[model samples]
Target: MKTFNVPIIYRSPLISAIKQQRKQQDKMKKDFTPTRLEFGPLTILLARHFGFCYGVENAIEIAFRTVEENEGKRIFLLSEMIHNPQVNSDLLSRGVRFLMDTSGKQLIPWESLQPEDIVIIPAFGTTLEIEARLESLGIAPLKYNTTCPFVERVWNKAEQIGGKDYTVIVHGKPKHEETRATFSHSRSHTPTIVVKDMEQTHRLAAYIREEAPAEGFYEEFKGQYSEGFDVTKHLGRVGVVNQTTMLASETQAIADYVRQAIQEHYQLPDDRIAERFADTRDTLCYATNDNQTAVTGMLNVEADLAIVVGGYNSSNTSHLVELCEEKLPTYFISSEEKLISPKELLHYDFHNHEELRSSGYLPQKENITLLLTSGASCPDAIVEAVIRKLAGFFGLEHLVDETAAAWA
Candidate 1:
């Protein structure tokens, strides 16, 4: 609940006023209902919890502070700071460069890095290999590290489960930076493997039950399991953890499935289940839970469509779009500028990783309703801009200003 000294450009008066009014109305934040902003025929239902989260604000504060404190030194980020393109672009405009892409592809040569050069570890953290590499270069990775504490908590959880002699089964995208970092950390502590979804979990369960051959395990889970991991030995006792940004429900489902699998495989009674399975809650981040829950709340209201704003590569943002798309038409856009016209718009399909043009995105009805929300990494200014653009279509700029003032 702490506020950070982020760049003023990322803030919006309208959004701030609305948030301030809500804070005054509900001090404990027990309300999950969407905030209704009415302007003539257009109604915007803003999620109660969205936009910059604690991890993001912390990263921004540390990143900008690093830039300000070190004026002349070359600055490099291990990867995209927080998955929002605008925020990353802003940092780039300020002379900060990225050493690697989100997929762990090295963009800059490791030989170029020097001990004096300021290197920032992103919110997603980095692999142990990368940390050791930085240390070998005489660069202290922790001094400018902005790795989120919530992520570190997942690693700690994995370590705790490992201490109990349980093989760590991570439910997450294997290629994601957070997952890779977690796998690196957890494998160092114990045998670890990454399962992307229920399908992968089912296959892993087959191996655990001895229905599949060990050779098949090596083939199916290549590069996803820790080195020296023996399927026959390590899969005996398992625990579940996940990338913090994953969908909370899916994580729970996977954990439940794996727990049931272990019980059935060993023919263990209820009391003996703990011997084969380490029962624990899903390690989802707070922002992920709040944002996903807010999306569920937003779905209860009737709306023409939903507009989800965030970086296309953002896992959390894509999940938000998925949640919205399940009930109604949803547009995944990074910026308000994507609202090209009243009749036409450009949006990105996160799954396809391509931009497409859509016609008749807006309804012809006089009374328009839209569910608007953004990912945790998105800036409030971007969400406000989208609202203003939509309001412009209905000539409701004055109404928006008056509403913001009244709320203030």
Candidate 2:
């Protein structure tokens, strides 16, 4: 892991307690079972890895620096700086405005942008069209751009596959900015299409097998396919790529399904199929892989409930919630504010795309355990706040220091 110079804002008493807790946890490492700490009525089991990732940190650093350096100059973001609402809200508070929303809706008119204004591209890279527009305005996109290097790496892989005359089949949410940017970059070299999940991949496979009509492709794919893309021709020799934050297993499954479809259609075996399609491994960021893997490891514990903290619309955060929900009841919350009480909590339902309240969210058992994790863009401070809130509900606020000590 690369070392990040993030500031630690631990409250004094909490810091002391965390240090003590760390000592105890370190001492009991070998024979460690589920340790119970009383915080009023809540029991929390922190995941091994959670909170802000390197790419987010790097983006925040650059965004803040740009704000400080360009005082009195207008600053615009290509999109939400990162998925966390709090982070975007903080940037907005500092006079940074977004040109586009998460779904690629243009909130600020491009015609309004000036040559002197600074535009910071989000961690998710912008489409080539947006880059060109910014350049036309004399605003160098790369000057203040904060696109993650990992995302750029995926684009590079797409280019490499495209150069080999293979169509790029991207496994990601088609509406996502990263997917759009990647698709645009890939289309410069070869035909590209985006698949959101297994269902979409299945439809794509059917199309590849000539079971689906070519005219229906536009309606099914909508805005997902590259301009001038030919469904029949593009699906013949395709390579797989993915959004850097997509579920690792899902991406692999989609790739495998596509590969199989091509083989069957061409009457080719595994060795022959390799000549047409590139076997690219997952493009998920290390933070995403580590956090999701850590959540999986945490879920081995038979917890009564799980809490996944981050912006609801956050892709990587939603994936964490999905992973946790598979094993136990999971609450996808934005902050500690969502923890209303021991019996009630507010959470976002990814399936329905709505925020709903639930009762009996926290079990009242004395030894109840919770699997706690957060999205890549979430801050540890918010996680700490959640711990405090849970402890307060259980009337174990005094144990906060002790718990902090354990972690330290």
Candidate 3:
């Protein structure tokens, strides 16, 4: 992992100290145990892996350097460079404008783009159609592009599998920027369809088994399938890929379900399973895997509650919240400011897509234990602030500095 020279404000002394100590102790980052930071009555258990990932750091470095170097020229991002609000707002404060929203809705008309204006592709990448449009505008999308290499690897994997005469089954949100780009690219080579989760994949299985009428496939899938995609023909032989941010277990379960569906439908033997279901590898992002796994490790310790910090709309963040909510009372908040008090907290429920206030979130016990972690895109400074806020409620703010000094 190469480090970046991001803004200092995003760095956290406490978190950095702990991370540095752990790196010195275990350079490979193979240890999945959570870091314990105890301050008398308050105990914070931090996940082993969290915060800005390699792709995010690379994107941030490129975006910031672009802004610093191209001073006076109009800068436009194809969409959000990343899911973090602070990062996007920093770019906006630096005079960078977004051309479109996450849903591909045009925020600025395409006709307004000038030849000299810099256009930055997001970390999730963009559709080939958008790339062609940029080329037509005489803008080199590649030069200013900050697409994550991990995402590009997914596109390459899809191409490789599609070349083997397999339909691509993308497990992701249909309208997500990453999935849309992947669907556009894979459909160009082979028939591709997007399935949001295990539910949709199960529904797709019915079509494969011929239990559902083929005529209704169009209505059932509607805009999810590729152009000219025939449900009867394309669902025969398939391979699965994902948005790289989905829950790893759910993605694996969907793959297993589809593979079994193919086996049962075609009556294929174990050795001949590849004929119907392409034996493809998992395409989840490394950060997603590590973070999810760290969440599992964090759950090993009994905590009163969990606080997950990230953008409410972030898929990866939402999955973390889901993992925490399964076993404990979890608070999904964008920042520490949402920690209104020890008794009450304001948090976002991604399932309902709303911000709600909760009472008696914190327990009345003298010694409080908490599990704290953030999404791949969240800054460590935000996480530090959250810890400080919680410490403030217990008058243990000094303990943070003491712990950092002792660790250092």
Top-scoring candidate (lDDT)? 1
Taking the candidates one at a time, how many backbone clashes does each contain?
Answer: 0, 18, 0
lDDT of 3 by residue, 282-361 (tens): 89999999999999999999899999999877889999999999999999999988999888889998888899999998
**lDDT for each residue of candidate 2 in 1-408, tens digit (9 for 90 to 100):** 465544354123443344346446665333223334556445677765567777888898898888988999999998898898888888899899989888988899999999999999899988888889889988898898789989999999999989898999999988888898998899999989999999999999999999999899999998888888998788889989999889888988999999899898889987788777787778888888877777777777777988899988899999988898888989999999999988899999999999999999877576677878888888777877888888887677768877656655
TM-scores, each model vs. reference: 0.98, 0.91, 0.98
Point out where model 3 deviates above 4 Å: none
lDDT of each: 0.93, 0.83, 0.92
State in Å the error of residue 49, model 3.
0.8
lDDT of 3: 0.92
Candidate 2 off by > 4 Å? 5-42
Task: Please write out the lDDT profile of model 1 over residues 240-348, one tens digit for every residue.
Answer: 9999999998999999888888999899999999998987587899999989998999899999999999998999999999999999999999998999988999999
